[model samples]
Target: FAAVVGSVQDGGLPHAGCRCDNCQRAWADPAARAYVVSLALVDARGEQAAVYLIDATPDIKFQLEMVGEWLGPHPQRPQRINQPAAIFLTHAHMGHVAGLSQLSFESMAVQNLPVYGSVKLVGMLQETELWRPLVSQLDLLPIADEQTIVLAEGLSITPIGVPHRDEWGTGTYGFKIDGPAKSLFYMPDIDSLAQWAAAETVLNSVDVALVDAAFYDAGELRGRAAVRHASIHDTLAFWEKIDSQLVLTHFNHTNPLLNPAAPERAAVQAAGATLAETGMVFALD
Candidate 1:
């Protein structure tokens, strides 16, 4: 099963300092709070399952518990460690890679954790003074664009380069997970649909597509400069071109789609797309 563990943008629900209606509701209701966008793939066909995470989100602690049963028992500790077979980082963004700190000596102290990312990403982790200590504990594996990493007999993940803000020149990745049953394309952060030359072809090749839905429209940006993310409006415009099941995610705090009663939700549904929600599980076997 593939679990959508978290469904909000970087900062998560009850955003750092925002007091919007949705943020207020998130603060008041624990259930309303969402972690950063992350996905976990669990191979549940055998007696024991293997787990792999798409991103090391800030909420890794809680997100790991969500899949504790599948992770099974830890070798040394009484409690199960949040150890995935490996973690395939999409990029070096705060929401995506910040959770690596949890696996360091100060916390989980996980040894030889395989962290797969671009070559530059691995370098950044090792070169950065603050993260050097944590980097030592990890087995950093470099992944190239379109390179496939086999997880098990019937499961593999390929990281495809996508256009986005590449601060360190490492670039961004949208993974194509080939499961026993079908393929899943997860493009969490992309500048625009038009920028990707193979956007249509790659999206159509997959069975499910969990794409960036950071904002609904220009209004969400308000006075701030536009972020390099695809709006739900643009995503819907290409709905008919995508042959796979579409699921929108990585919603910013200002997105109106967070409101259950918002017309944007109805519009997205009417256009044949669904919003990603925490705990939503898709079968891989």
Candidate 2:
């Protein structure tokens, strides 16, 4: 099963120092807090299931705990850390790679685990003085665009290049994960639907597509320039005819869809696209 571990955008719900309505409500209620977006794929066909994390979000500690059953107990060390089989990073964004520090000697001290990312991403992680020691424990495998990596006999992942906010020109990827029984397309941070020529074809090919839904409308931006992410309304319109199950995720704190009663949420559901939530699972065929 591929689980949706966390669903809020980079900063997560109740974003730091913001007093927006949603943020304020989240601050007042523990139930309202949402972690940064991340996904986990668990292969439970064997005695010990192998777990792979899609992104090492800032909330990775809690996200790991959420999948403790699959991770099981540490084999040789004390039971303080439950490690995933590997970590695949899509980019170098703070929210996406922040939790990498947790694996350092100061924290979990995971040993010799596989960490996959672009060439530049792996180089940056290894060359950065602050992360050098911790990353030394990781086997950084640089993945090329469109290259397929086999996880198991019937499961594989391919990195699909996509356009996004590339600060250092390090490419961004939207993974195409093919499982035994079904396929999944994860495009958590694309700039816009118009930018990708293969968007429709790719969405039509997958069983489920968890896409970028960082904003609900342009109003959320106030007078500031709109960033790279696409609004939910835009996604709904463009993906309305796709055969795959369109699941919206990576929500910014200001997005109205976070409110259960909000019309935005209703609109998405009525249009047949599901909203991603923590712990939501999709069985791979």
Candidate 3:
């Protein structure tokens, strides 16, 4: 099963230094707050469950707590929660990689934890002096594009390269997780569907696709420079003919779909797409 630990975009619901209406609601109510986008894949077929985290978001601490049961207790320190078996990074974005700092000497202090990312992404981490110490504490593995890594008997993950903003020249990846009886595709960040030539084919091939829904429309940008994330309106239109379950996620603070009462939420539902919520679980079998 795959557990959604967080559903909001990088900065999360109550974005820093922003007093937007949505941020205001989240600030006023704890229940309304959300963390950055992340997913926990759990395989409990054996005596000991295998848990893998996709994207180590800035909200990793709380996100780990959400999956504490599956992680179980720490092996060395019984009082603390066990670290995930591995972490698969999607890109070099702040929300996707910031949580690594928490796992360093100052905090979790995880040892030899396998962290997978693109060759360039891993290189960037290994070359940075600030992260050198943390890098030594981890088993950094560079993954090739479209390479399938088998985690267990029937659980495997393939990191498919996707078009997105890559300032550091490190590519973005959308993970395709194949479980015993089902497959899921997770791409929390993408520049645009039109830019990806294989977008339709790949999305339709999966049982469920948790895609980027960062904004409702261009208008939400408020005349700012164009962003890389795809808008909800464009995503819905692109997946109109697809049969796979289109689960929208990675919402920005300004996105109207975040509001339960917003008509855009109903519109999305009417279009046969559902919104991604934290703690939502998807069965693999």
Return the top candidate by TM-score: 3
Alpha-carbon RMSD, each predicted model: 1.2, 1.2, 1.0
lDDT of 2: 0.89
State the RMSD for candidate 1: 1.2
Query: What is the lDDT for 233 in model 3?
Result: 78
lDDT of 1 by residue, 112-230 (tens): 98999998988888889999899888999999999999988898999999999988898899999998888999989998988899999999998999999998887777763447788
Better of 1 and 3 by TM-score: 3
Please give the clash total of every predicted structure, in order: 0, 2, 0
The TM-score, computed over Cα atoms with residue i paired to residue i, of candidate 2 is 0.97
TM-score of each: 0.97, 0.97, 0.98
Off by over 4 Å in 3: none
- Model 2 Cα displacement at 63 (Å)? 0.6
Q: Write the residue-wise lDDT of candidate 3 on 1-285 in tens digits.
A: 998999999999899998898999999998889999999999988887878999999999999988888889998899999999999999999999999999999999999999999999999999999899999889999999999999999889999999998899999999999999999999999989889988988998999999999988887867534577887778888887677999999999888888889898898899899789998999998
- The candidate 3 region of ten consecutive residues with least summed lDDT is 219-228
Residues 10-92, candidate 2, lDDT per residue (tens digit)? Answer: 99998999999899999999899999999999998989899999989999889999998889888787565568999999998
Q: With candidate 3 superimposed using the best TM-score fit, by how many Å does residue 150's alpha carbon deviate from the native?
A: 0.2
